[model samples]
Target chain A: DTAVSQTPKYLVTQMGNDKSIKCEQNLGHDTMYWYKQDSKKFLKIMFSYNNKELIINETVPNRFSPKSPDKAHLNLHINSLELGDSAVYFCASKLRDGETQYFGPGTRLLVL
Target chain B: QQQVKQSPQSLIVQKGGISIINCAYENTAFDYFPWYQQFPGKGPALLIAIRPDVSEKKEGRFTISFNKSAKQFSLHIMDSQPGDSATYFCAASTLGGSEKLVFGKGMKLTVNP
Candidate 1:
């Protein structure tokens, strides 16, 4: 079984459309993260949640929001997406503050 | 500012040769350094990791060399095989608190048979 999983492996949408990506982890981890990988393959952190509490919020645009319903799940919602938002979004999970992270396959978002 | 900077965006090595990827971080608080391996259409996986206190760590054919004072780390693959070809990323995290990892751009390594 996949430890970490994300839904909608591929998403294609038009500009001004809103989309959401769901992530779930069964590793019994307390922290979850969202990362964005651009065309250049530069991966950057977008948001992080520890025990369902927001911890790190990078300088990402306000259009992106992360919601953690529990310690096992964290979802990302993008509003009014633009062409620049097209990228591969990854979901990762860690046991706590000291454990290594396990990542999901990743969701590819395409905006036209 | 790029907290973690990786060099040689891509590398090609012979099947039996050694492959090395280097990374440098500016933060002194970073205590844990990890190297992640990623294949096409797959997410990055934890390959090996090292702490500032340790000078080097090894697992199988993979080795991680770390220099605390220099704030630099590197991953070396010995007897590299064609199956070892993949994109590798270096990441750093603090001791406590958020522990949000900062990853380098990435290094694509190709081991030619």
Candidate 2:
């Protein structure tokens, strides 16, 4: 079984379109995170939820919102996406603070 | 500002040669450092990690050398193999804080047979 998984392995959308990516972790971790990897392969943390509570929110645009219905799932919703939104989105889960994080295969988003 | 800086954006090594990737962090508050390995079309996976208190750690052929005073660390892979070809990322985080990780620009390593 996969420790972490994300739906829509690939997403291709036009500009100004809205999209959502769902992530689920079977590792039974308490903390989940969303990271964006640009063309340069630089991974940056966008948001994090600890047991369904928002704990870390980066300086990302308002268009990006993360919702965690429960500790096992965290979803990212992008509103009015732009061309710069093209990147690979990865979901990660950690057992607790300062622990190794397991990552999902990632969802590739291409906004035209 | 990029908190963690990684060197050799790309690397090539022979099958039996040693491969090394270096990284430096400016955040003294960072207490945990981890290296992640990623293959094409795959998400980065935790390879090895080290804490500021530890100077070196080894797991199989992969080793992490940390210099807390210099705020720098490196990953050394011995007996490099083609199967080890992948992009490696260095990251840092502070425990009991936001717990958000700051990742470095990845280094792509190619082990040639």
Candidate 3:
């Protein structure tokens, strides 16, 4: 079974369009996170959730918002996407707050 | 500022040779350190990890060496094979509320047979 899974493996949208990516983890983890890998392959943290509680909120733009409905799911919504929003978004889960994180197959987002 | 800094953005090593990647962190509160390996078009997976209390930890052919005072750590891959070629990332996190991991720029390793 895939421990961490993300939907929309690839997303191609036009500028000013809004899109959402869904993520789910079956590892029974309590903490979930969203990370963005830029063109340079630099991974940066965007948001974090622990048992459905928002924790770390990085300097991501207001257009991007992370929503966690439950402990097993964390979804990312991008509003008015711009060309710079083109990158890979990854979903990860950890058994504990400060332990190892298991990542899902990233979703590549391309805003034209 | 990037909390965790990794060196030698890319590396090439012969098969059966040792591959080394280094990292450093500025946060004194960082208590946990982990290394992840990622292949093309795939997300990274944890290879091994070490805490500040221990200086070294080994699993299979991968080993982690940590220096608490200098806030430095490294991953050593013994007998690096062509299949071991991938991107490796180092991360550090401090325990508080929700431990958010800070990752460094990844290093791409190429093992030539």
Candidate 4:
């Protein structure tokens, strides 16, 4: 079984449009995270959730909001997506006490 | 500022050769260091990891060398094969609490056969 899974493998949207990406993990992890990989392949943390509690909120725009309904799911919703929002969004999860994070197949977002 | 910095953004090596990637971190609190390998269209996967307590950790052809005082670490791939070509990212995280991982700009490794 896929330990971590993400939906909408590819997203092509226009500016001012809103979109959402979904993530799910079956590894029974307690912490889930969202990372953004830019065109330069630089990966940076966006948001983190521990058992549905917001923990780390990086210097991301307010347009990007992460919602975790449960421990197994964390979804990202962007309001009025901009051109700079074009990048790969990855979902990762790991045990609360562990350091290893398993990543899901990234969702390629292209905001035109 | 980038907490963890990686060197040689890209490298090309011939098959059966050795490929080395280096990384440096500014945070002393970072106790967990890991290397993640990612293929095209795929998410990064954990390759190998080490802690400040150890200077070196080897698993098969992949090895990680860490220097706590200098806050430096490296990944060495022995007998690099074409199948091993991928982008490798060096990351560090301090355990406990949120444990947000800091990753360096990945290094793209191309192994030519």
Candidate 5:
């Protein structure tokens, strides 16, 4: 069984469009995070959720919103996506702070 | 601002050779440091990690050397195999704080057979 999984491994959309990428983890981790890897392969944390509560929002634009309906699910919804938003989005989960984080297979988003 | 800085954006090593990647962090409070390996079309996996308590930690052919005073750490792969070729990212985070990991730019290692 896959430990951490993401939906729509690849996404292609036009500018000004809206899309959502889903993430789920079965490791029973309490902390879930969203990261963006740009073209240069620079990984940066976008948001983090713990027990369905927002813990950290790393100054991401207002167009991006992260929703965690439950402990096992965290989804990223991008509104009015732009070209700069094209990148690989990764979801990670950890059982607790100061623990190992397991990552999902990432979703590649392309905005034309 | 890149909090964690990595050296040698890319490297090529021969099989059975040693591959070294260095990283430095600006935060002095970081307590948890980890090195992640990523293959093509895959997510980054934790290869090895070391905290400040121990100067070095080894897991098979993978080793992590850390220096708390210098705030620097490095990953050494011994007898690197072709399968070891991938992108390596060094990350640092204060587990006691927000637990947000700050990653380096990433270094691509190509092991030639």
Candidate 6:
């Protein structure tokens, strides 16, 4: 069984469009995170949710918002997506705070 | 400010050779260090990890060597095979902080048979 899974492995949309990516973890982890990998392959943390609480919010633009309905799911919603938003968005989950994280397959987002 | 810095952005190794990737962190507060491996079109997976208390940890052909004093760590792949070709990332995190992991740029390793 997949410990972490993401829906819509690939997303292609036009500018000014809003889109959402869903992530789910079955490892019973309390902490879930969202990371963005740019074209240079530089991975940076965007947000982290622990037990449905927002624990970390990096220097991301306001257009990018992360919502966690429960401890097992964390979804990313992008508003008025721009071309610069084109990158791979990854979902990761840790068993607990400050522990190893397991990543999902990743969703490739391309904003035209 | 880049907290973690990795060296040799790309490397090529022959089969049965040893591949080494180095990383240095500026934050002394970081206590947990982990190495992740990623293949094309996939997310990275944790390969191994180490704490500041230990100098080295080994699992199979992959080993992590850490130097707390120098604030440096490295991942060594022994007997590297073609299947081992992938991108490796080094990350660090603090204990009580936001628990946000700081990742290095990443190093692409190509092992040729």
Highest DockQ against the true fold, candidate: 4
Per-residue lDDT over A4-48 for candidate 1, one digit per residue giving the tens place of the 0 to 100 score: 999999999999999999999999999999999999888888999
- Location of the lowest summed lDDT over 10 successive residues in candidate 1 chain A: A94-103
Off by over 4 Å in 5: none
DockQ of each: 0.81, 0.87, 0.78, 0.92, 0.88, 0.83
Name the candidate, 1 or 2, with the larger DockQ value. 2
DockQ metric, candidate 2: 0.87
Task: Please state the Cα-based DockQ of model 3 relative to the true two-chain complex.
Answer: 0.78
lDDT of each: 0.93, 0.94, 0.93, 0.95, 0.95, 0.95
The deviation in Å at residue A5 for candidate 2 is 0.6
Residue B98, model 2, lDDT: 81
lDDT of 4 by residue, A1-112 (tens): 9999999999999999999999999999989999999999999999999999999999889999999999999999999999999999999999998889999999999999
Model 5: per-residue Cα lDDT over A7-104, one tens digit each: 99999999999999999999999899999999999999999999999999999999999999999999999999999999999999997744688999
Q: What is the lDDT of residue B112 in candidate 6?
A: 93
* Residue B83 accuracy (lDDT) in model 5: 98
User: How well does candidate 1 reproduce the true complex, by DockQ?
Assistant: 0.81
iRMSD of all candidate structures: 1.2, 1.0, 1.4, 0.8, 0.9, 1.1
Candidate 4 local lDDT, B1-113, one digit each (tens): 88999988999999999999999999988989999999999999999999888899999999999988888999999999999999999999999855888999999999999
Number of clashing pairs per prediction, in order: 0, 0, 0, 0, 0, 0
A1-111 per-residue lDDT for model 2 (tens digits): 988999999999999999999999998899999999999899999999999999898988999999999999999999999999999999999987447889999999999
Which residue runs of candidate 4 sit more than 4 Å off their true CA positions? none
Chain B TM, per prediction: 0.98, 0.98, 0.97, 0.98, 0.98, 0.98
Q: Which residue runs of candidate 1 sit more than 4 Å off their true CA positions?
A: none
Which of candidates 1 and 3 is the stronger one according to TM-score? 1
Q: Write the per-residue lDDT of candidate 6 for residues A1-112, one digit (tens) a residue.
A: 9999998899999999999999999999999999999999999999999999998899899999999999999999999999999999999998774478899999999998
**Residue B82 accuracy (lDDT) in model 6:** 99
My TM-score estimates for the predictions, one after another, are: 0.98, 0.98, 0.97, 0.99, 0.99, 0.98
Q: Compared with the true structure, what per-residue lDDT tens digits does model 6 show for residues B14-91?
A: 999999999999999999999999999999999999989999999999999999889999999999999999999999
Over the full model, what C-alpha lDDT does candidate 2 score relative to the true structure?
0.94
Candidate 2 Cα misplacement greater than 4 A, ranges: none
